[model samples]
Target: MGDLVLHLDNINKSFGGLSALSDVNLHVEEGTTHAIIGPNGAGKSTLLNVCIGRLKPDTGKVTFAGEVLTGRQPHEIAQLGVARVFQTPEIFQEMTLLENVMIPALSHRDGAFRLNATELLSKQGEVREEAEHILEDVGLKDMMMVEAASLSRGDKRRLELGMCLILRPRLLLLDEPTAGMARHDTNQTIELLKKIKSRGMTKVIIEHDMHVVFSLADKVSVLARGQIIAGGDPQSVREDPKVKEAYLGGTT
Candidate 1:
């Protein structure tokens, strides 16, 4: 097997008496796209939250790059090279796209969100150059000077991705990336993700779109009732009986 990058062992979580995760275990190989799929309330987001340090699991451990991350803070985990793209776009609607991208790029370089006005202005050109290059890569170079609020849904998602890429993260976790996208936009995202995969950035995606799942995932895991019922390569997992039942007789 490839060198493991992220591992979850016996992860469990709950609210009151409702179980969100139960003995959930997952292994993500380095430089691979691992997709996690489940119906609503199947604990997919909870598992991701645990992995990214947004929620501390009631029990179990999360390890990344050989270091235990179970108790680390979200920023601490990010410092360890993890980035997440939420279901909706996360950007500064009032700011220019270039400004939105440059903020994180600047933070990545300066080690935090503190920079004097003079120093910021002095470094603006360099940071702007880097942010522009990333925007180009994400196919948003033309929108650099435009207000973020004016971009289309797909473009907004692209901008959010650009923000994450500014960190040069080793692992990217995406939750429902194409949820509200049209077919054309979804296809565009697929092509963009294809490029990202070619660059060897490991990704763990939680999505309902089988087309998107099969398009990018190197391995697939299906979650149901807060547990993984089937997992393997795309073809095999797609044909698994338990997965079919979990998708309500294979409708999903």
Candidate 2:
């Protein structure tokens, strides 16, 4: 384990009279996968939103890579080496997979919107090469020119992850990366994540699948009703009595 790459302190969020999160504190070590698991209403999505600047917590602080992220905009957070992949694949449905991946690499080089053709032409080759490299890494090189909308659910998820990889973010927040996939596709995703883990990429994953969590997570934090009920290694947290009682059905 390395230094803390992400930290949340005294976090709180609410909707009307209902609390989505309360006094939540989480620390993710650098170069390790930290899995956050909970029941449906455990505030997992809410916590990710706060980390990525999608929704601000009513009270608390979010820090990433030693910089405060509580009030930064989504793009600003990305600039700070944080990228998020949502439960649903976020990609350009009308564009080719290659184009979709290239857009991010281009944006990473210049600004998000660089309309100057002269400047773009000068940098186009480098950008395309980077995008192609990313596509190859995510197992989509053969389908690079395929329309994103034509991809199956599993391929679309891989494309979205490839787009994030183009940015080479230090911290990746994945919200159910293997959601809605067949067993074969899920296995592929697990292998892909394992490869990324081998590269020492830090990730915070919120997943309902224990197989995925135990397969990848170095540390696990079980959340319930907006609070952390158990925190430890996979076996320890899986065997915790309170965790089993609250969420795991008392089974490992």
- Model 1 TM-score is 0.95
Model 2, range 1-252, lDDT digits (tens) per residue?
A: 678889999999999979999999999999999999999889999999999999999999999888999998898898778888998999999999989998788778875565667564445787888888889988899998889999998999999999998888899999999989998999999999999888777999999889999999999999999999889899999889899899889333
lDDT of 1 by residue, 154-224 (tens): 88998999899898888899988888899998998888888888767789999999989999899999999
Q: What's the CA RMSD for each of the models?
A: 1.6, 1.7
| lDDT of predicted model 1 | 0.88
Worst 10 residues of 2 by lDDT: 114-123
Model 2 scores a C-alpha lDDT of 0.90
**Clashes per prediction?**
0, 0
